[model samples]
Target: MTTELERELKQLIIDTLELEDVTPEDIDPDEPLFVEGLGLDSIDALELGLALQKTYGIQLQADSDDTRRHFANLRTLATLVEERRVK
Candidate 1:
């Protein structure tokens, strides 16, 4: 089951990446966001990172393992936003 945060994140990913071929309903929260599931590349990651920061006031370190873990999928990304986003 997808949480509200996950749903929102899915839309954010779509909008941020200009994924005209994708839709929020098409995204599987458990699937990988990069290289396989969504087939997003490193450039997509950078774009998504800026979108997340701008939207949620979340900060990230470039090339960090923790950042990689958070970006692993929709669920983890939502969790990161929930935990660190400014109110």
Candidate 2:
């Protein structure tokens, strides 16, 4: 179940970020997305937040204390949606 969530989240990240060189398998759920692993920047975070808002109907309050915690990685992002998204 969580694997599926991870995959879906990975796909969403790749699609939303326009990562032409990356596949769903390229992402590491526990790795850092901003500094090292996937090399995402601030703009990418904003884009991802918008994509999540559109796709999962979950809004991320920009620059909040929870934003970093929520968008930490694919796992965290998926968990955030699973926890907050309405049916």
Candidate 3:
């Protein structure tokens, strides 16, 4: 079952990225957020990161390996946000 954080992150991703034809229910928490899955590109990553920071007040270190892991999928992203969220 999907957690509330995962659902919220899925919705945030769809809304922040302006993903047409996609909904939170359509996203798989374990699926990758880029190329092979959602097909998001580098620019989308940047935009998503900015949106996450603004919305959650969490700091993301661009060069950290954890950042890459965090962005791997909805579940990981939600885990990261839950760990770091200040709001």
Q: Which stretch of 10 consecutive residues in model 2 shows the poorest summed lDDT?
A: 56-65
List RMSD in Å for every model shown.
1.1, 1.7, 1.1
When summed lDDT is taken over every stretch of 10 residues in candidate 1, the lowest stretch is 59-68
Q: Judged by lDDT against the true structure, how good is candidate 2?
A: 0.84
Over all chains combined, what TM-score does candidate 1 have? 0.93
How would you order the candidates by lDDT, starting with the best?
A: 1, 3, 2
Q: Write the per-residue lDDT of candidate 3 for residues 1-87, one digit (tens) a residue.
A: 999888888888999889989978889988899887999987898899999999999898757576788899988898889999999
Q: How well does each candidate superpose onto the true structure, as a TM-score?
A: 0.93, 0.89, 0.93
Tens digit of per-residue lDDT, candidate 1, span 19-60: 999989999888999999999998998899989989999987
The sequence of per-residue lDDT tens digits that candidate 2 reaches over residues 1-87 is: 348878988988899889999987788898888767999988998899888888889976656678998878778888898988864
Residue 18, model 2, lDDT:
91
Q: In model 3, where do residues sit more than 4 Å from their true spots? A: none
